[model samples]
Target: MKKIIIGTLSAMILFSGCSNFLKEDPTDFVAPVNYYKTEKEVFSALAGVYDILGNRAAYGRYLFFEMDMSDQCYMALSSTGQDIALYNYDIGDQKLVDTWSILYQGINRANMLLERIDQSDISETLRDNYKGEALFLRAYYYFLLTSNWGSVPLRLQSTKTPGEVDMKPAKLKDIYAQIIVDMTSAADLVGDVTAYKNAGRVSKSTVWGILARVNLKMAGAPLRDKSRYAEAKKWAEKVINLGYHTLNPDYTQVFKNHAQKVYDTKESIWEVEFSYMSGSQYEEGNVGSINGIGTSNKLVGYSYGAQKIMKPYYDSFGVGDLRRDWNINDYYYENEPATGRIVYAGNAAAIFYNRSASKWRREYEITPQKSVNTTTINFPLLRYADVLLMFAEADNMSPEGRSSQAEWCVNQVRQRGFGNLLPGAVPTANVDLPTGLDVVDFQEAIQKERSFELGFEGLRRHDLIRWGIFLQTMQGLKSYKASAAADYQYGFRTAENIKPRDTLFAVPRSEMVVNKLMEQNSGW
Candidate 1:
């Protein structure tokens, strides 16, 4: 069983710079100085840091909705107004306020934990581990902030009074520098994967994987720092060489494992844990409800049908790619047992609207009934397959473009997707990379591989943005959706409406109104 970290911080540290609308006065709150006297108290504090992952505003909702803005999926016509605004790139919309608030809340918890843990009388190893976990989490939150908003205010220390709060945005480069420093220190202090009792917690491999992603972002688009390309490759390679993780061979089993609350630590590096059994609505994860096919679709018994996969993206998969069959379900099983009796729901046009994000299928969920929207399925934050793809992309960007190592890394992912096809066997069904591609072509191939392999996983938008093709790709998608013949139609976005400033989200209007130092991104 996965060790579920559950704890509540005694005091909620409000962002004091913001007005009364944003601040919540503490009640019966034990201050950190008064609380961190015992080892259990310090561990409970660390659990408080992990608790942020279960917040609806953070990974549970906003993060998944942001994926709709990418080319991978579209918000269904029945989706919430806020989701529509987000998908349409309405920069001034207040939809992202929760995301901004919750992330800062997490950072505050981490800061408080780091501040108090040092004074505790815990064993040296225990202290180091807790410190490492806090540092990694802090860096992770900062990464999410910097990547989404570009220049968010840096708050390393816990805010004791309203006077100490700084609302000024820091440079992205400086934020990234801190991220690297924290993660590097985290990797050193944290125990190896084997040392960790559970897969849910951070390990040495987790730090390496995150560092690879961070370095890759620094090397791409806005930064264009070529030096980081080599660093990115180094980190990804380190994770691969560690031998603690490997591909899960069967792609379909991965999600099934998630639905059953089974942890395949080999492929899943780290996952955000959720449980409907927890009895608190905040603890439930709802990705399936938001994206699954609705009962109105005459297929699934229950679902919100809020988001559907875009036709263009679904069609982009190769002819025999197992991911297409696994990720996108054109049909639903008739009976409760789901005995492979596939009933074709509709033709291409009809299925487009009803197309289910089958990755998180409700049928696979081990709940008492199918009607329950809340699921215990953990959302994968990082996986070994992602690491392999990162390695390939980073290596291709390095001086050795189409190096043998790059080829091997890319092939490993491809091979796994192809059901671990034997060497020298003709992969006619699951197509492999064509031989003798140049650096440019190999890079393009890697991009396509990631798209096909990692679609609908909330990574597409960031990937496109870092590749410097987000705007152009969305522009093309708008035109493609506009011209496509589908049974159900909704207004598609236009290229002319998307400004370069739309790349970074607007600082929440509520936040901007209260803080004089807060600045909105340009054209917002």
Candidate 2:
């Protein structure tokens, strides 16, 4: 699924050098004066817009480990200095600044491409697809911004110079409205999943699935736009009715495909592709190394095993549910003799809280001589299972109430979780969610189901925040950890440090300095 365009596009950015810093454009070095002249150049520019998804500040690191350290997991080994996981970060925190800057860079790249792509003489079909992708990506970037920062500067046009950086913030609802508009238009313009045959590119299914997610966010806390629930269900049903995607039968194989740099489009609808080794060098991500099971031996993939699954999340899995062991490792790798052999703990209560998130184990990586700090595993952005769950959740939230269709959707996911994939295979009674749950009970079921299926995939934080349970969930962890053994008390630091303002991260000081019209979020 990893494309060759990444190398060419990055090289284009690097080689677009300037002799005089004062005279050259500062917003982006890949100047339009000499670029976007041909069809291939336009494609390369589109790849540049996609490249930011793998930047170190996004899915490459902070997204899965740093920003997403919610009630499900915590960093086992703290970094040398300040860390965002504990929620002690301020406006000047470099992690926040890098993430904010990287997202804007992506938006700017898409803006530049969209602004110039119409001049190209490419085939009408291809040009429209590229335009659609750029529009969707620009909106997706804003989704990340408003979802995290509340209100933000909605820059539709590319910035030309340093003087163009002082735009004021747009209200959160306005930004969401633009997201819906851009995504809705992109859905009509983009090709279908069969056309792309991979999750790396934007397709009709990708746009609709994500639109469901965006509307669900609006329907939940903060926005409280209940009408959007029906809209979310409408988009999610579109993806389902398209009949191009389904569960991959084996749940673990879904992630194993990512770990081994393979694409399974049936399960993974969209992904941020991270690659390794073009010719002599590598471009990788800190997926397995930082978040996988710990091992000092490079041969087994040197991992700090930074993240530990919270014991409560570990225990949330029901008996005979297969996802528990696959997601939360029940063992560690010994560093002795550099072979990094496993040391099984058998899901013992003593070590429950110490288990690593093993969804992206480096042992599955086929590349030779894995890097000490990075791997080629891709990060999934949207999956079919997620779409099914979203549809169910939205249907339950709609005035129609919980329907049999919603129950069936949740059952399909739960049955797969219990390893019942074949049509004739009987779903384990204990594993399947009970039928005819009331509105509130069914909603709670969807919440736990999402955590069980999508934990440690860089989504738990946003899920908690949108559901209005972020602070309560963190505080719940504090009480849960308080009852644990003394050694486990260290896990409660996140809850202790969290404040109501922690719901929205502070605007980066760098942006505040330049955009004088921007006001800080509540409580700095």
Which segments of candidate 2 are over 4 A away from where they belong?
1-31, 79-81, 278-282, 336-343, 346-350, 422-427
RMSD of 2: 5.4
lDDT per residue (tens digit) for residues 1-524 in model 1: 01111133464432211111111333355655677667767766677667666566666756765433576666665344444234444444545777777788778888888888878988999999989999999999999888888888888887666554446888888989999999999998888887754467888889999999999999987888889988888898999998778888778788888777777888888877765432544456676766654443223335565666667777788776778766777666555433344656545655664566667776676654433555555677788989998988888877755478788878788876776554455564535687788878988888888887777676878898898998888777665654445544452432334557766777776667656687888767
Model 2, CA-based lDDT: 0.80
Candidate 2 accuracy as TM-score: 0.92
Instruction: Give residue 460's error in model 2 in angstroms.
Output: 1.1
Task: Compare the candidates by lDDT and give the number of the best one.
Answer: 2
How does model 1 score by TM-score? 0.88
Evaluate all candidate structures by whole-model CA lDDT and list the values in order. 0.70, 0.80
Off by over 4 Å in 1: 1-28, 77-94, 296-301, 333-342, 345-347, 368-371, 421-430, 482-487, 494-497
Per-residue alpha-carbon lDDT of model 2 for 207-274, expressed as tens digits? Answer: 99999999999998799999999999999999999887889888989988987767788789888776
Candidate 2 positional error at 276, Å: 1.4
